[model samples]
Structure formats: structure tokens, C-alpha cells
Target chain A: MPKQVDHRERRETIARALWRVVEQRGIAHASVREVAQEAGISHGAVQHYFATREEMLVFAMDFASEQTSLRVAERVAELGDAPHPRDVLRVTLTEMLPLHPEARATSRMSAAYVLEALHDAHIHARAREGLTHGRDLVEDLVRQAITDGHIDPDRDPAIETNLLLALTGLTPLVELGVIEPREATTTIAHHLDRLFTNRP
Target chain B: MPKQVDHRERRETIARALWRVVEQRGIAHASVREVAQEAGISHGAVQHYFATREEMLVFAMDFASEQTSLRVAERVAELGDAPHPRDVLRVTLTEMLPLHPEARATSRMSAAYVLEALHDAHIHARAREGLTHGRDLVEDLVRQAITDGHIDPDRDPAIETNLLLALTGLTPLVELGVIEPREATTTIAHHLDRLFTNRP
Candidate 1:
């Protein structure tokens, strides 16, 4: 038999090269030839994997999203049966925060993808879908929290979900050290607490 | 007599070219030659102003921040004497949000700068300073709101200011239409009202 070739693995290998490029030189350096050089592959190999640069960018973004989702799922799986709704929400949303090294790494790439989403329809759709999925998940959590009497019953799940979703956008400030990690923690905590309280 | 050259004007023109490059092709295409071509100047002219690409990026980011500040100031100046503190804040912050066409344009460039700030120290400092300046202004408004009895008497101005400052980062989502303009307005309104209330 000829040498075995796993196309998926090769693609991921190329994607990792893109990640390395982003890490070392930022997305400005993630050209096809540059990524190919990083991956120790020929230009044809990169072309074989992605027909266009936009396709490669889309795949990289999707790959990053899957990594983040896996990290969240891994943590969620480790939770005990019927964990406090607040704690579950916090832990799940923590992956969206740049409070940890892993989340910070993913956020680095995610931010670039967000900027790209402005000019690219595929990226905009993917990002919009990702954000919608996140907010829907938040709505479910809010409902669960309300049902468990862990949060205020009067909260509008839609707006509340957006509020929580918007807080994740603050991660770059934290990553930049403009806002301390403790401050970001406090802000997120305050938002969650306000949701739970009925006092106004 | 020798012709007089305004260095500031030259830099701004080059920065405008960078902005146009960002606007037309995204920042990924903002190479020195491209920006020089866009500015109708020579590559040596671009090199003359900034020794390195990083230096040029810094200048462009600073230029954008200055542009944002000027727009905010102009809007504030348009308001009547002692306008409602809430309205003042809403209008000022609306500039920071991608709720309008102009803001969405600046935000396109801004989000790209933010993503770059994560890896570049100089960009990080510029971003940090800009954010700190914003929060300080928010603190001033929060103080005025409290003094004027427009907001809660016991609110932590620091946290409230941070909350408002962090909200500006959500412009990318708004640009992507992940958060509709009405929703963003509602979110900001809710946040401002919460600050003004004794809500827990």
C-alpha cells in the first residue's frame, strides 16, 4: 500500500500552522505561502486543503470554535449531578471569559475572526450563528435559574441573555490588563447577582 | 523660500490612507506600499514618517482614537446647557456603539485595532489609555448623575464606570447584527437605569 494519508489530519495540521502564525505574527502574516511554510508543506498542499484564503480563514475560525466548545463541554461533563444553576452558568460562561489561559488563547483568535466578520459574509454568518447559539444557551440557563428560584422571576430572558452575552466582550480589556482579572470577576459577578435579585 | 511641510498634516493624510485601506480591504491589506499608494505618496514618504510597520500601526491607532474623541466632543458640544444627564450619556455612548453608520465604520477599524492590541505592547498601551480615558469620563458623568440625583446615591462609581466602559467593546457584535440597535439601546438603558436605581 502507498503511504497512508489522513486528509483531515493534514487539514488540522495546516490549521495549526495558521494558529502558530497568528500567535507569532498576528493574522496579517497568515497568508497561504506563510502558513504553508509554517506547516512544512508545499503551496499545493495548502491549496489542496482550502480553495481560497477565505475558506481557510473560515475553517480556522470553525476550528477555534470547536476547540472552545470542547473545552466547555469537558468542564460541563466534570460537573456533579444537578450543580447549582448559577455555578453551571458561571462555569460555562467562564470559557467565554479570558480569565484563564485556554480561554485567552481562544479569545485571541476569536477577536481576529470578529474583525474579519465585518468584511466577510461567511464569517459574519458564522459569528452571528455562534452568538445566537450562545444567547439561546443563556436563555435556557436563565429559565432554569428562574425555575430553581435562583434568579428573579421577572427577568426578561431575551434582554437578560444579551446582558450576559455582552459581558463576554469585556474579555479583551482583561487580557490587555486594562481591567484587572479581579475587576472582570467582580463585573460578571455583579451582573449575575443583579439578575438574581428583585430589589430595584 | 523653501516650501513648508506640515508634519502633522502628512501623518494624518497617511493615517487617513490607512483608514481607507482598512475600510476598503480591511487592515490586512494596509501594507506600507498599499498605504503609500492610497495616500498618493511614495513608499519612502511612508518610511520617512515611521521607521517600522509597528510605528505606523501605532500612529494609525492613535489617529483613530483622536478621531473618535473629536466626534464625541462635537456631539457633546451640540447638546443644550445642562441637558439631561441620561441623554448626555446615551448620546456620548452611542458614538462608542455601532448603532449608526459612522460609528459602524469607525468600529470596523477599531475592532481590528483591538485585536492587534492583544499582541502588540504599544497598541496595548494606546488601547489602555483610551479605555482609561473613557472610564474617567464615565466616572465624571456618574458623579454628576449622583450629585444631580439622576442616579442612585450609593452606587460604586468605579464599577458603574467600568460597566459603561466595557459596553463599548460590544460594537463588533452590533456591527455583525448579532445585537440589533434596538436591543443595544435597551441593554444600555437597562444598565443606566440599574445604576440609577437601588436594584441589587
Candidate 2:
């Protein structure tokens, strides 16, 4: 009898291989043949899962976003009604950091896709959706903080949301050694504290 | 007799063509042959100036950085000695925005080079140098703001510098229409005003 493979497991394996290729060679090289080689499969095998390179890229980008969301949700769940907006924001934003191998790999892959999106409309649309989703999550958290009286009521949610996203973009720069990590972390923390703290 | 182009002018033309190709077709298609065709020159003609694709990329990346620096320097020069630090910072950061076509093209090319830097060591080195130079400029401005009593003396320069750079990275997202441009601009302006204002 032919060997039976778990379909979801195989797809995950392929996605993981795609992430590695993106991380190691940049997304420009995340072609079918390249990802197949990384996945220890034939190009046809990759085609079996993804009809086109765009399909694979879209799936991979979505997968990464989902993973990040799940991670943040898990962490937030653990927070268990933490009233402090700063604490909630810190946990959510820091979860996106490349503090471990998994997070680092995901970040590299996501960054590659983001750059790729600038060139490909399909990827661009998906990236926009992902960005909106992520921004919404952070925005909601900020709103929650306000509702809980953790953040200054006078603060603008729209401004704080953009600031948080901007800070998140600095993580890959730090991971890539473009900025000193300690300084990046300290700078982000200080800015966050200022945004959250009460001051006359 | 064949016309002889000035070496510096030839190289600059090739770099501009490279950037145009990047903006038109995305960085994924920025090969020597394509760039040469875009410049209406022979492939060998491109090599005459750049030697190799990697060298071309580095030169192109440097050109973009230089463009940004020149713009900022020109604005700073106009400010003279009595310029407000807040105004200087706002103007300098705004120069990095993809508000106009030239800046937009440059921003696209820079993003392409940034993705390439992830996998190309030479490109990565150049990117690191460019980022460091930018950060240094921001740090100097931050220090000046403090000395001018435009910002809080207790505000950390390092963090402020990162915040400024992070804000630059977020601009493309807005320009690309991945995020609402109005929201981005307003949010950035609000944050900068809050961060740099002396009145607290």
C-alpha cells in the first residue's frame, strides 16, 4: 500500500521550508524550485500544494500573520485582565520581537514579504490586510486601556496606534544589527511610557 | 568617432536608470541587462561603470542615501543659526517621506535594496553603514534640540533617535496605501510634537 501522509502536516512542512528560504535567501528567491529544495522535495511537490508562486507567497504570509496573532492572543489571555495599558502594549509588541529563533525567522519572512508586496499587487493586498489586522489589534488594546482608565483619556487612539506600529518596524532593524538592540529597546520603552503615563 | 561620455556622468546615469527600473518593475527585475536596456546602453556599458550587479546595487543604495542627506542638508542650511529645533526635525523627517514622485521612487529603490541586504553581505554592510549615518544625524539633532532647550533635557537622545528612524520606515506603508495616509501623517505629527515639545 502507498504511504499515507497527513495533508495539514505536509503543508506546514512546506510553509516552514518557504519561511527558511525567505529568511536565508530573501523572498526574491522563494521560487518553487528553491522552496522545494529547501523542503527536501521536488518542485512538483511544491506545486502540488501551491498552484503558483503567488499562491505560495500569499499562503505563507497569511500563515505568519495567523501565527503572530495566535501568539499575541495566547499572551493576552495569560495577562488575565491586566488593567495597565502599558503592560498589555508591552506584551503585545514585544511578542512580535525576534527574541527567539521562531520569532526571528517569522520576522525575517514577514519583512521579505512586505518588501515583495511593494512589487506584487496580490502580495500587496494581502500585506495590507495583514497590516490592518495587526494595527486593529493594537488599536483595540489601546482603546481598552483608555476604557479601563489605564491610558490618558485625552490621548488619541489613532496616533498611539501608528506610534506602536512604527516602533514594531524597528524590531527587524535591531535584529538585522542595523541598530543597537539595547538602545532600541530602551528607546521604545521610554516612548511607550511617555505615551501612557499621566503628565500635566 | 564615437562620443565619449564623462565617466562620472555615465555612472550617475546608470544609477538613475537602475533606480527607474526598480521603481517601474520592482527590485526583483533589477539585473544588469535590464538596467542597461532601461538606460538605452549596452550591458557591457553598465558593467563599465558598476563592474558587477552587487557593486551596482551598492552604488544605487548609496545614491539614495546621499539624496536624502543632501535634501536634509539643504533644508538645514536654509534654517541658519536661529532655526527652531522642532521645525528642523520635522522638516528633516518629512524629507524622508515619499510625498513627491522623486522621493517615492527613491523610497521604492531603497526598499528593494533593503530586502537584498538581508541576503547579500556586501549590500548588508552598506545598509548598516547607511543606517548608522542616519542615526548619527538624528542623534546630533536630538542633542541640539536639548541644548536649544527645545526638548526635555531628561529626554534620552538614543531613544528619540530610534523613534525618528522608526517613523521614517512607517512612511512607505502610508505612501503605498497599505495604511491610511492621513492617519499616518497626523499620527506622526502628533507624536513628534509631543516628543519634542518643551512645554510637556
Candidate 3:
């Protein structure tokens, strides 16, 4: 058996290759052989990490989601202690959009997964879980803002959360060139201003 | 030479078969042969209408979108001349969601196209056009509501249009059973209430 570190490294390498294939072609075209060729590894090596194509795709999806979460965490850390509630909410939500080239791939994977989830139960559950987690995060922030007097106490946090997170649904339009990334960001900022009661 | 009526009828038949294939097995598995088999027509007949696979897919997408629009128009016609703005907005947006069995297929196809648009230039353009059209419809509705004093005039019509239509983004989650269709409708109604100043 390989050591733990080697096993983790091999899996990471395979997942990255899978993402590249998914990014270049649609997920439908990301066959095991395609990923193997992209990774410069044998099909057997790729199988050693993920026995089935579904397994590989699921792992890659989770990995892409984790990468986004990590980036958000890093950005929050850079904001230092006591970041404004609106600023934190803005940064976190903006990170979810495909505003940057680096984020475009993950956003694409996510959009692909939404369709896949329609046909597959397991993928559906994972996609649902990811969306729920995102909603919960935004809801928490909205609740904090309300408590901090940044937003109206009369507003329903869940509805606000849903509305705010739904804006990320425009991510595909941004990616498809229907709207500019800057336009999406501007829309988000505009909505945020409306949500906050006391604007600086 | 085929008559104009025959040309239109044949294309519509082929497009319906293509939609069935897409609904059953997803857009990736929708091949010309599969669509032909489903339509009970010869492969040559299918080819006579659509010389290429992309042409067939694009036609089916437009057909499906048109079907949804027709449904919306029919629904609005039934609502009489004095329909409230909120009711009009709710019904229009609800029609876009995959809340019914009939709509689930079109919703799935739309979701699949979001991924396809990422890799195909022609599809990207068509998808962009559809999104822009949807946004415009919603924006126009918001403007009318503001003018009628149904909503606050201070709200940015474009931003409100974006946020309202973005709720349709939750359609996938509803289709996947992550949330009930009723919950989505409820959320839509909740937001509409928040938008209107004098909710009875």
C-alpha cells in the first residue's frame, strides 16, 4: 500500500487533471481515458484512486467546491479581525461568482453538476448539500447584520438569504458573456445596499 | 420540393423527438439516430431537416423555450384585464420554474444548455439571447409595477429584475427534490410581498 501522503498526492493530481478535462470540454466528454491522458498517468493509475467514472467526477466536484471554500476563507482572513458585516457578506458572495479566471472553472463544474444532479440521485444529494451549506452561510451573515443594526430587524433572514444567494444564479450568465462579471458584481453591491438599513 | 407547411411540421416533429430524447437521457445522449428512432422517422428524414447535430439541438432548445412562453401568455390571458402586478409577476416567474412534471423536462434541458454554452460558441449566443430576453421581460414588469405604485419607485429596475429572475435559479434545486416546488412558490410570493408596499 502507498503511504498516506503519496496516496493523497496521487488523488489530488488525478482530480486536477479531471478538472482540466471538464474545463476544456463539457463534463460529458471527460472520459476516464481523457483524464488519464491529461494527467500523463496510466488508466490503471487513475482507477487506483477512483474505481468508476462517477467516482472520479464526484471527487473532482467536491474538490472544486473545497477550493472555492478555501479561497473564501483566505479572503476573510485577509480582512483581519472585525470586518464589517456587509463587507464580509460581499466578499463571500462575490467569491462564489465566476468573476475571476481562476473561479470560472469551478463555476463551470458547478453548473455542469446541476444538470448531472438532475439525472443521478447521488449527485443530486451532493449538489443539494452544497447549496444548503451556501444558504446557511449567507443566512448567518444576514442574521448577524440584522443584529448589528446593519439591516432591518423586520426582514425575514431566510428570505433575504434566499434572495441574496439566488443572485449567484446569475453566475452562468456572467460566464456565458450575457453579462459582464463587473455587471454581476455591481448588481450584487446594489442589492446589498438595499438590504442594509444604515448605509455608510 | 417540400411545401412550407410540411417543412415547418417536419421540423416541429423532429424537435419534439429531440426534446423527448433530452428529457429521457439528457442532452449528451441526444444523438440524431436516437431522436430519429424516438420520432418514428428515418435517420435520413431527420437529416433532411437538420444537417448537423448542433442544428437539431439548437432548434429543440428554441422550441422548448417558445412552449414556455406560450404557456405564460395563455395563463396571463386567463387572468383578465385587471390582474395585479404582483400576481402577474408571480405567475410569470412561476411558469419558468420546473414545478410541474411537464416543465421538469424543459428545465433539465435549460440546465444542460448552461453547460453546453460554455464550450460551444453558437449555443453560447443562443443562451445569452434567451437570458437577456428573460431579464428584459422581468425588468419591464418591474418598471410597470413601479409606475403603478405597486412597488417603490426608488428601487433600481434592472437590479430588481435581476434578483427576481435569479429566483428561477432555484428551479434546479426544486427539480432535484432538494426543496419542494411549493416552497419555491412560497418564497416567490414572500419576496413579492416584500416588494409591494401595501400587502393586504
Candidate 4:
């Protein structure tokens, strides 16, 4: 069991190294050697964990997504038990945006991976899984808001969920300085306000 | 004048070849040599038009955006004079989505260029310009809609414009099969219906 745990920990370290390389030099430069150097390990040692650069990139992407999810979970947990659906959503979606420096880096990495998905079936499947999971979570919260009379019952939970997800798609604009982070947050709040019009 | 025209046309041909390279083989494979082969020209010929791969890429990105804009303009023109703001908006927005194969390929190319924009300042500036221009056009239409009493006056035209632009950000999801193209169009229509609620 300890051996297995060590194996997982080693992989995580390598993934972290890959992320650092991606953040510092861009995904295009995140080769096995570069990541190995970033991790302060031998290139073969890195390959022991990830045989190919694609494999390493995929693991790093999953690791980054998991980290984001954990951060979102922490923020949501701060709301205490039985928090409002609106607050839960706001926290999750805001974390997903590239508003802050760290989130901005993560968003850039995600953008690169999405493009990579076009050429790599494994990456595409992973991206699809992440998108579907995010959609399901948001859809559930939207449905709960409706049931609790926080939002209008007539609103289609599915459509509302998709719109909210789509709204976060503006992260690139925010990153490009075309949309200010404050304005992006405001737009989210505005959209939420429209949806939660029935709040009592 | 003839010589100038030929120069411009030759560049266009090279850019088109770059697009074909990107469409068939993801942007990573879109080297000057590959594009030259695609264009049925010598590597030196492509170099004659674009001294570097980066220069070629920037030109190709601009070319693609211009093509998309022209297509959108043509679609909008089909609405004829004084088309209702809603129809104009719908046509423009729908045209932006990757609902069809050509649009989908273009969307993939755009996604790749967006990631490239992270590393290349020229591409980033171009992306910002495109985003800003798109935002301005949408904002104007939203303002006109308000003036015409198509949408409620209470809505902030800027925010509404950002939301609509952000909504098209879901092109990646649709490409990943996380959302059907049909479902995406429905979401757009549904959002439009909500915005145009004040329609008489």
C-alpha cells in the first residue's frame, strides 16, 4: 500500500513539474526533458512515470483540473451546510474564470489542451469528461434552485445550466483584456440575478 | 496596380493554404514547408510571401477572421434592410457557432490560434482586436434593440453584449461533443427569447 501511494505521489510530482513548464514556457515547450528539468529530475526518471510527452501532458491536465475542482470544493464548503444554490454557483463559476493570476494561468493551460484535444483522442476524451462533469454539477444546482423557489420554476434547468457554462466561455476575452475581470464577474452576477428573479 | 494586386492575391493564396494545412493537420503541423506543399508552391515561394512561420500564422489568423466576418456580413445582408434586431442578432450569433462542418473546422483553427496568442504578442493583439470589434457590434445592436423597444430598457447593453459574446464561447464544448450543435442553437434562441421578452 505504501509503495502504491509512493507511485501516485511520484506521478503527481512529475505532473506538477509539467504544469510549471507549461506555465513558464507554454505548452509547446513542455517536452519530457523540459518538465524533467523543471522537476529537478533526470529525463529517464520522468519517462519512467510518463513514457511519452502526450501521456505526461494528459496527466498534467487532469491534475490541474483536479486541483481546480478541489479549490472550488473548498470555497463551496466555506458556505457551510445548506448554502444557497446561487452562492454555490457563483463560487464555482468565478473560480472557473481567469480573473485572478493563478486562475488565468490555469485557463491558458486549458486553452492549449483544448486545442491539443483536436489532435489527440485521449485528450479530447478527457476534456469531454471534464466538461460533462462540470455541466452535470451546475445543472443539479440549477434544478435545486428551482425546487427551492430561488429561481423561476418555468426555467429549463438544462438550458439554464448550459447558458451559465457558456457564459464562462468568455475567459479568453477576459484574458485578452477585451473584458475586464470585474466586468466578467458582473456579467455573471447579472445573469444569475435574471435567473434567480423569483428569490424571496 | 496589377503587380500590387498580384502580390495581395499571392498572399491570400498562401494564407488559404495555411488554413488547409491547419484544418487537415492541427496547427502544430502547420509549418511553412507543409503549407507550401499544400499550396503547391516551393518553400521559398511561401517564404517570399511570409518570411517566417510566425508571420505566416499571423496573416492566416487575420485571413480566417476576415473570412468569418465576410460570411457573417453576407448572412446579415440576407436579412435585408431594417431587419428586426432579434433576427439580425440571431443570424450573426448562429453564424459564429461551429454548428456546421466548415464553421467547426474554423472554430478548431480559432481555438488553436487563441492558444498561440498566449505565446505570440502579434496573435494576442489580433485576438483582442477581433474580440473588441465583435463586442462593439453586438453592443450597438443591443442598444438599437433598446431604442426600438425590442428588449427592456433596464438591461445594460454592454453586459448583454458581453453575455452574448461569452455565450458563443461554448464552441469548444460543442466540438468536444459535450453539447450538441442543435442544443447550442436552442440555448441561443432561448436566451434571445428571454432578452426580447418585451417584444410587442
Predicted model with the maximum TM-score: 4
The per-model DockQ list reads 0.56, 0.61, 0.61, 0.70
Model 1 agreement with the true structure over B82-112: per-residue lDDT tens digits: 6677767777777877666556656666777
Best candidate (score: DockQ): 4
Cα lDDT tens digits for candidate 1, A1-200: 13235777787788878877776577888889999999999999899989988788788877878888898878777887866666666666667777776566567777777777777788789888987776677789888787777778877777777777777767767866777888887877766666777423
TM-score of each: 0.86, 0.91, 0.92, 0.95
- Which residue runs does candidate 1 get wrong by more than 4 Å? A1-6, A40-44, A144-149, A198-200, B1-7, B44-52, B143-149, B198-200
Worst 10 residues of 1 chain B by lDDT: B1-10
lDDT (Cα, 0-100) at B115 in candidate 1 = 69
Pull out the clashing pairs in model 2: none
User: How would you class the docking of model 1?
Assistant: medium
Off by over 4 Å in 2: A1-5, A77-83, A198-200, B1-5, B77-81
**Regions of candidate 4 where Cα sits further than 4 Å from its true position:** none
In angstroms, the error of model 1 at B88 is: 3.1
Residue B55 in model 2: lDDT:
88
Q: By summed lDDT, which 10 consecutive residues of candidate 3 chain B come out lowest?
A: B171-180
- Candidate 1 residue pairs in backbone clash: none
Better of 2 and 3 by lDDT: 3
Assess each prediction's global lDDT (C-alpha) against the native.
0.76, 0.78, 0.81, 0.83
Preferred candidate (lDDT higher): 1 or 2 = 2
Better of 3 and 4 by DockQ: 4
RMSD of each: 3.6, 3.1, 2.5, 1.8
> Clash totals for all models, in order?
0, 0, 0, 0
